[model samples]
Target: MAKIAFILLCHKDPDAVIKQAQSLTAVGDYMAIHFDARAPKAAYDRIRKALADNPNVAFAKRRVKCGWGEWSLVQATLNAVETAVEAFPRASHFYMLSGDCMAIKSAEYAHAFLDQRDVDYIESFDYFHSDWIKTGWKEERLIYRHWFNERTQKKRFYAMFNLQKRLGMTREIPGDLEVMIGSQWWCLRRRTVEWILEFCRTRPDVLRFFRTTWIPDETFFQTLVRHLVPEHEIESRALTFLMFTDYGMPVVFYNDHYDLLLAQDFLFARKISPEARELKRRLGVLYASEGARFQISNEGQSLFRFLTGKGRIGRRFAPRFWEAESSLGRERELLIVLCKKWHVAKRLTARIRALTNIPCIEYLFNEAGCDLPDLGGIQSSMSKRHRHRRALMRMLFEYYDTERLVICLDPQNLDLLEDFCRDRSVSRLLEIECQFTDAYLGGHAMRVGLAGERTPKETLNRLLPTIRNDIVHESDRIRDAQFDNHLRIREIDPPDVNARALAAFLSLPEDIARELANTDHLFAD
Candidate 1:
């Protein structure tokens, strides 16, 4: 018979560990359990007693404390694999599982599946395009921004820097290599397992460096596999379809119930608290029913079935829902204004642009509505304020038409636009209010009245023409409003300054406004 080694490195949760190991007993498999040496002796003894009846079980050599974000977990895993290989030399494959992982299907099905693959089943993925790197980094930085939190800031910063270095980011940057990330849980052929162990042995210093590192469990195996065999066949998705515990148990979902010694399902149906005897009674009924093999109905009956085991019967089902794609190609031209300093708005805008492909035209406002210099080109300047606004305006009008009119906004200054439009139009506008305090990680309040009823595409389409008409009206209003007021404001005291600034700024409208006005451009009309 083909043999498989189930290697598990566990700490603290011995009862949970033994419960997981016991499920494997049905398959007549051999297992190597490495309980961290640091665990309490009484706890360790309890685990040993639980598995004493199993003839295929053996204690692993040595013990190691596994710390999250530290390399000790990886080390313990490596140690367990070595011991398993030594004890089960005849085994064809080795599956690395956690104390929390439960087998969803029968062991026979799992074994057959692995045999067919003829490759290690490691869940690996390209990390370069991960949104985690962006959002996680931003969150970490924000946590460090408070003046009172200098000590914590230094620690997190160092951790990030160390992580960047270990992933081979030293000196000259290479374009070909991408960071690999995945769940540490995986199954590997015996040869693959041996190769990994041998590689780590050959490079002792590399292992030593990662020993003190943070979140090393995720990186250590990934880095080693990438370095050893960069083109190895690895699965990019998880193998099991079971719900995992926060502690990492992969509890088996059985169809039948034996006398309620243990309930091994992804999730327990009935509560087993306060009254153990009653819980056992329900479990006995469940076990006798062969794991309650029933399909759930479409009308939220699955939750009821899974929880109470008393629900309307029907076939299994999943709901259909539409998920929005990143706005890569489709972007409306936009002009963003900010009441705050340019730097604050620039960072916010960069994040927004990264999230969406929307084109942006930015403006900054002081007490007076005088035009500020373009700051886009200068690295030291926050806003891209140096670019020719007239050129940008022409591009927006020429390429974009009614299908895509520009978005003009002061995300920080909603007051300026309050009187600019009618109450209804203002109501339709999307106003996102963000908090600026460290305690509150900036809450967003979107004022999308009737627009909320429409899909994003429809909302954009409906709003575009209204924005174009408003921009033209505003340009005319600003010029007319400034004719006499120019003399009062010292910035434009010269008679020619009013027309000159407005002419340069409004040049594109003079050319395209009439063309746009003549066209039947309203979305509804």
Candidate 2:
């Protein structure tokens, strides 16, 4: 009977996943690996052969052709968990993780930590009534029926976003259960795993509903666990540390994250690329020297102390990383929007491009599948968008000349940029972020500086909701002389303000939304 069973959902890199599985063999922990059904035959064969000799590791009988934000991801995870449980009935815990995840702590240390804790570790938040994730975005995930992308097998269904915005297609939350959203990765006790398997078998309707929802993987397991178990029995923080780029994408672990990874108290770290072989080697060395009991070895403790400060490593460094900056010559000007409102971002980019020769290289997050053209280097590269935002940012910084860069971070991307820039000295760079104040912007929401440049902070505040309204509604009425005159005379109070409030204000009309939806054909050629 295995003490721990690791269920790994792998897609891109098999070698790293195999190494991760190897690290768990200290106590004869079983592992069930599920390769994506769509993965190339060659890649799948390589993984199978690599683990064929190991009796403890098994391949999932049911492989899923998984897609992001689709039922397939959930299906794959379920299949792996079921396989692991069936294979090792005496396994005390099931650790659900991705191929990209690497064990930072030794297996003995992890088991010891889990042994002492009576609660399941899974990050969760009130998906129904929480301000943690914006209400509009959350509702969109709840109400709208997001379809699978035929091409890349992802949740890039722009049509759903458009229809939801235009027609406001929505369904009431299930009365029986409250929706929960969190990190897809979690470690559950055998009892909890069994309950989940049983809950899933019985609740086909819930599964069907989440089938077409955006990023259902983040919600399905979390919602089920919250429903099945007592609130006190669950620890909301999943013991994994993940970093994000300034653009809210996952940051792939690299050599620069060496100090950060050592400082983290998390048991696992994720999205490590093959390039970080040295870092991977260090982790492998760390895990190799495990004690007989479920605790860190003396060597492990020494390594921790040597890497970090005098005391034991704490959770304070969980979401931090050294900035990977370049000393290139070109003064790169970046206008980064949290991308809640694509049209506003596009318009802002256009305005900036027209005003100056300063290149307005923009990364727009397209929630709605409007086939927006790449206007003057403004990109809608969903392929690149899907990559870890940190990796993407690193790639950008490495490739682009960003010596003197100016970035505008919206509310969502602000913290990400802070973490990404923590290790670098950005004396020449300026970061502009939107903040709410009592002061009004043209009878609308209170505003902050535009793109953090040297402009008068008060004057640049006018570019927010007003510019947002203009782009979202596809109307210049707010930009007209009459609107300006009215704003000067009377301050029209804005509604409840948020990062996405501007997006919600200008609801898409049915005709326009449908017409824009039709334009998806533009990219078909």
Candidate 3:
């Protein structure tokens, strides 16, 4: 059996780690887990119990609490590598992963990819030129600068910052080679790990510098790789591109195009639930068949139902609205309802626009019909009747801008008002509704509904700060409103509202400028 040692530094998400291990074990692979020593004993025990049946698995000796820009994580990973090498000397490759990450490919394909490379597959690219010595100095400077700006002790912080800057300036001229920085995830040949161990053991200066440096994990590995094997090709992207994210934790998307079997090949993985297992099995069988490979025929019709069935009943019933709209195609009027009740809508719109190039006309109900032409006949029975009229006005204005007549339908009136959008020239009016009935009824639920084991509370807490920050940075009018509210609210000792208003003012997006005028937590309980 071709041996491959998978190393994981787990803190949170033990369940995810266990499920990932189960997937790897199913594919006949050896695994090694290192639970963070600082994590709860119950968590450690749970992980240990989960992997107890697998003879190939063994726990690491020492655990470390890893912090960003800290060296302890680097040391812990190094220790894991050393331990894995000793236990599985015949193992051809070693893969490093975090507790939260997941594999996209099966073990067999993963091994084949690594075998072809023969070198490490870790992303390490420089933003500047290769010969830029200042890059290294600047990286070091940035660490201290961040510390000084954010730290509590003013005098001591500046003192250390100045001292570091001076030392960085006087440090020996850096080599023609540049620092290689990339994703922490890497698949390395066993020989490469051995070579790295030997280099770290003998290099006293490198060791000494890493122990004190702020960016130990990134800088240490980068400097070491650059100095040792400058010519080796390192993969610039994550092996599993599906889990990649611009901000926040990496998330996996299970789609028909992606092969679920390949996920077993990943070095580290988050969990796959029972629902995902069924989906994977159905997809695997569908894809495995010869006739299904050419095209999704009548014979494979059951596959679509199997994959998209279960809780996607509403999706099955609803028409494919998104299918007709091209991302780049211009529309006459894109009417957007900035509802006072859906705070998550504001955040979701900003996030969507940032990720995709989609554009829309955002208008609050209060300001909707003021400057815009009222095409009339837009009414709804919802608590906010005036808001629906404003939505109609906004849609009318957008229609004028696009030179295409389009209608905006509020959720309350969508079913009854199909005639408004039935005209060939009229673009379809899209309604953003909550698929999760439980979340919809719960006032505190995020605008974006929860999916698979995730609670509305957790999702909202994670997303709210980002939404608030984006809104504040995008709008100055909101800032002024917040300032006025702060003066008035603080006098009455209403700190919570004041703080919330300030946060909203600072973070509300410019595109949703009219939305913040109400200053109420739309999703709050």
Best by TM-score: 2
Please give the distance, in angstroms, between residue 378's alpha carbon in candidate 1 and its true position after superposition.
26
Candidate that scores best on lDDT: 2
| Model 1 regions lying over 4 Å from their true place | 126-134, 137-179, 230-232, 241-422, 425-525
Q: Of 1 and 3, which scores higher on lDDT? A: 3
The residue-level lDDT of candidate 3 at 522 comes to 26
Q: Which stretches of candidate 2 lie over 4 Å from their true place?
A: 134-136, 150-156, 164-169, 291-525
Q: Which lDDT tens digits does candidate 1 get at residues 201-304? A: 78775665555444556656765666556364665444533333334443333323222113122222221222233433443343223323322111112221
lDDT of 3 by residue, 1-525 (tens): 345788877787687678767665565566678777778989999989878878777777777766565567788888788778887777887777776455544455455556666566666666244442333355553234333321345586558767867776434323443556555666666777888899878876666555655555655666566566645455544453323233444444444323322322233334333346554444334322332211111111222232333222121233245423322134332333323234445544454445333453343333334234444446333334343433444355454554432223333333223322332232333222222223333332223222222333433344345434433332332233232111112223343543443234333344343333233542332
lDDT of 1 at 339: 18
TM-score of each: 0.45, 0.54, 0.46
- Among all windows of ten consecutive residues in candidate 3, which has the lowest summed lDDT? 292-301
**Model 1 poorest ten-residue lDDT run:** 439-448
Q: Cα miss at 368, model 1 (Å)?
A: 39
Q: What is the Cα-based TM-score of model 3? A: 0.46
Write one digit per residue (lDDT tens) for candidate 2, span 422-461.
4333312121122223243322322222222222333334
